[model samples]
Target: MDLPAKTKNISVILQKPKYAGNIGAAARAAKNMGISNLVVAGSAKYDQEEIKKRSTHLAADVVEKIKYVDDIRAALDKFSYIVGTTARKGAARGPFFTPRTIAEKITAVSQNNKVALMFGPEDTGLTNDELRYCHAVVVIPSSRKFTSLNLSHAVMIMCYEILLASLPACAEIPPKLARSSELEDMYEQIKTVLTRIGFLNPQNPDYWMTHIRRLFNRTSLLARDVKIIRGICRQIQWYNNQKNT
Candidate 1:
């Protein structure tokens, strides 16, 4: 199969999945869509036989090359872009994108940045804390009565959309963005500075930082942008220290 070039930069991450079979099936889905990287994040170990059984011989390579990480955030830290999948919706959970729209966005993002398509565990989707790591969240539109989807099924739907989007001629590639690790570091600095300055509530600073995160995520910040923001934080801290002395 002549796969899309951008697809090579995309990875599918399964966070805290309970079933080995779902992991295997998700690998098969990834292979079908030309995505080679599959990461399993969490501490639980699964039976290899059960995993290989569901992946079958066709996706044996994918299972063989699966990357395991004890922490989802650590796995996500290396990627320049992350898209999370969820079924639930609330004021705090969204600004959600449809699979197709996010796929189109991913194609462009993958042109210059490593992109991760993150799916939460089957029973309970990604927690609010986990979703904070995502630059964008996608919700598969399903019947209102029962919105949840099986883990592998959700992976396949998302992978399919991404594959479809990547089939067309390439558009202008965007500038490379800062990695998640850098953005995370800057967020921590921003939180501290804001709290010290009394701009953010000291007791629950994360709640206020969620809005700040969204603002920066929408901006598609580059490496220089992160440095600029962090420099501002440092200057603020220095001035406050001088005044105290």
Candidate 2:
């Protein structure tokens, strides 16, 4: 595979989420759009682990990468361009645009600046205070009667728009997940080394190992990484056994 490319950096920032499912779904949507960074700020639901499970149909490992933060400011500290998603009008900050337009803005800024797309919680769209930091706001232009959207759906719509806007002219096919045989060999090596160190506890070991396996599996570890980790574990075991003797 080619070395990781220096591509456009686009981040999704979720503020004060009340549920983990929504966060997970947001993560799925972000990853689907080729956006790898998901930042969660403010309060979050405890069941977020489940959210990642449900939202990430095939990209659960990607969902696992979502980061939690305490404030929106911290969430967007490093981005060169920031856009807020909201339905409010004539009040926030500068000029506003539709989701498509926002995506276009993202593409434009992306040529030179990393961009951050910010979304607020389900209960409320972006609070006026958060808008103070935005370069512009992208409003969905919903009915005046009820403009609210479920957090995940909101993320999905935004991601779709962004993906549509940023589709490459040549569109290089993205890389595929690592093959399973390679993953199995890596797992076996890990189990062997763990057993040697007494970490795997041969007696009734399956119970604990099963859980660890699930966690690592959820990460969709690449075969290359599994081999690297296995080698490290082998070296550690060799060094430790030598010390004991």
Candidate 3:
């Protein structure tokens, strides 16, 4: 496939952005950079007037093609690589990448795999807990004195960097991996079984589950990996039923 076609493999995701204008601007930015997919995660509603005004005629198609999902995890499954963009820097953000480097890497990966570049809401960037779902974090270097970027500006810079880089050819297509939705289902099942077996404390189930999610997210589990882990959860539940009866 050609380079622009490779860019088509990227999905630009907005996570609960508060303003419709930001969503519209991000879509415009994506279109300007040859990206086609635009997904909005979480419950935030959009104002049509704002979207149209910000997108203008240039990105009208993108505005029309926008997808809405209930949450960030729900929107992530199909993509092989998930990159979270943030201005914050610290230990908990996981592996960090400069915008330029990550742009090239993501472009190369998109040759055969779906890639997602996600942005958080305007008020707060992605929560630490929300970021656990990302495989890597991309930080746009800015003056530390004033680091926070507007939602649309951040998306624009990331997309622009991607457009500047060249995607390397893949010698072989990678194996089919589990989608985000499938992993989410597996997590639910695991949580259920663990809760039933008293492995997850009722008082603070999230504390333990948060760690589990982060651990597994780093692995980028394949379809088979998900199946094997889910099978173990099923067995545990079955054994519990037998013991109770």
Candidate 4:
């Protein structure tokens, strides 16, 4: 039977995963639970063939579309809500939720915006530096000495629980596509205009394009919005040209 579209905001992000097998199995978990997107952060393994071999014929969709990112902050900060999965004890306040509670937090955020659920490296779990990016840290309820779980297994267990819990109360979530090409075109026009007006230095622009790309992606832009933006850019650029020459 074909699975329904995922309605929750939870997206599992693997940080610098070492083994292709682990990524493959993790994809299977997300796929089995009907999670569509799996994001990988850092200079990591995201090869299709390797993941396919490890997936064992499951989660082919996730394995095929896996995205790799060099910037951890860009990956984590893009989403409004975030959760860090780690079994380590903490001195300060943190909700030590069961797998069910982890699902709950995901649900709570799903009502509004996107979420990033992060898992750490293989040998060690999430580092303190990475954990700080998360709004809350979740500790899977387990034995004290052997509380830790394998990277992929932990994601699978959590994703499965979330998917199971949400099935009963699931509603129809319409498709949200990122047809961002129009936005990209508008940015190009904006850059041209800014350069013409001397607002943006073309010769020695300090990563301006990169920042603009990030900013544009951050906004929930639609195709129609891009058309309007393009027109505005043209008008402004024309006005600037007329004023000067």
Candidate 5:
């Protein structure tokens, strides 16, 4: 069966994944769940033969079309919404949702925005720095004693929920939002202006920026909203210049 139109906008990203077979298996899982866009971030080299061995002939097309980028930010810049998967949880890594919940949310966001589901390396899931790029975080439920999941297995579970969510008809589709690239630019400007005014600690600005990111992520900022915030930053910069003169 063909995937829902909105579901076609979803992309799966693997960051610094360690194994070729895992990548291949992940590709097959994504294809099985009607997700064709697969992106790999990081410079790790993998044996094509091993990858093909795992993906097999059924997912050859997915393997052939997999996108490769040098880093996670570049891989995700064009996407408007990004979800990061993690096994371990902490205060900083929080506000995590189940796969089903996030999948439903993605269904709505994917209606008008490009969505990315990002998974990290097999040994260690996404780090805090990497999770900063994600708008949301999802954790797969498992036994407490053995909470960790295999790389491809984790991909399969998330993909399955997204496919299930896409099966239903959606009544409301949101308007397109600002892409990650745009948001990042606005954030940089905000950070620079805020630091100039001492609103954010120059020694540890990102500590406070996390709160700012959380605020905007929850609001689901649109392109226009980003422009407004950036406009404010520009005005602040102008005021600072006037004061200096």
Candidate 6:
């Protein structure tokens, strides 16, 4: 009963979760889906009793092995692709997808790199600043009047979709996708080149990079693709420098 390698690489991150019981439930959800990695961000006192009570013994391993970090950003370093779950939507959160759609996307990305599904506190979903770290947003479609779901419920739905999406019978062979570190470096180079070429304004640079990130996230850019992009950016930067000199 070993989990798929791709699914095992997927981590379920709870950002500033409030309830210990919910954390335990979330762990159960992740374990049930064959995802073992669980991370909690921000120090929030939770009732361990509730956690033990809710998770019972079936998911004791997940509850025991949960990693704690001070911030959500701290957990992103190891993940190639990050998907943040949010109940609220706005212009800032660009390109939101239903759970099913995001699950498909996650499965594709996980095939080539480590992926994370981030969940915020029960009271408030991911903040704009926190969401900035994510490559995409997964929105669980619900009634407008009551869009928010319980923390564990959200975790369950996300994990369930991902489990279904990760089934070997339905999965495609993935290309060698770029790791997060490589993508981040490429993005930085692109940003530098864009600025050098006067494509991005320094004073009020906003969604320029954000839009680019979303586009690439959807494209499932491979390692080779990232290298090509970085090469082009390097040439642009060099050309800009030559012109200035």
TM-score of every prediction relative to native: 0.97, 0.62, 0.83, 0.63, 0.97, 0.87
lDDT (Cα atoms) of all candidates against the true structure: 0.90, 0.67, 0.81, 0.67, 0.90, 0.80
* Model 1 lDDT per residue over 1-245, tens place: 65565776899999999999999999998888888799999999999999999999999999999999999988898899899998888778889999998888888889889999999999999998899888899999999998889898999999889888878856778889999999999999999999998999998998889999988988889999999999999999999989989
User: Which segments of candidate 4 are over 4 A away from where they belong?
Assistant: 1-8, 45-47, 170-245
lDDT (C-alpha) at residue 212 in model 6: 76
Q: What tens-digit string does per-residue lDDT give for candidate 4 at 195-243?
A: 7777778895534654554455445454566678788888997888799
CA RMSD of all predictions = 1.1, 16.4, 2.9, 8.5, 1.0, 2.5
Runs in model 2 deviating more than 4 A are 1-8, 43-45, 168-245
Query: How accurate locally is residue 202 in candidate 4, as Cα lDDT from 0 to 100?
Result: 89
TM-score of 4: 0.63
Which ranking of candidates, highest lDDT first? 1, 5, 3, 6, 2, 4
Can you give the lDDT of residue 51 in candidate 4? 81
Model 3: per-residue Cα lDDT at residue 206: 76
Assess candidate 3 and give its TM-score to the true structure: 0.83
Which residue pairs show backbone clashes in model 4? none
Assess the local accuracy of residue 9 in candidate 1 as a C-alpha lDDT between 0 and 100. Answer: 82
Q: Compose the digit string of candidate 2's lDDT tens values, residues 1-245.
A: 11122234677888888777777777877666666778888754458568768675676766777787877767776665667888767532446778887776566555545567889877867876677556567888666798888877777787777777666432342223333344445556777778878888887665565556545644544446667877897898799789899
lDDT of 3 by residue, 1-245 (tens): 23543777789999999998888888887787778689999986789889978988889998998889998777887776788988778777767888997777676667667888999988888888777767678888998798889887888898888777754444555555567777778888888889889999977777788778778877777889999999988888999999999
Model 3, C-alpha of 100: deviation from truth (Å): 3.4
CA displacement after TM-score superposition, residue 2 of candidate 1 (Å): 2.9
Query: Which is better, 4 or 5, measured by lDDT?
Result: 5
Provide the clashing-pair count of each candidate structure.
0, 0, 1, 0, 0, 0
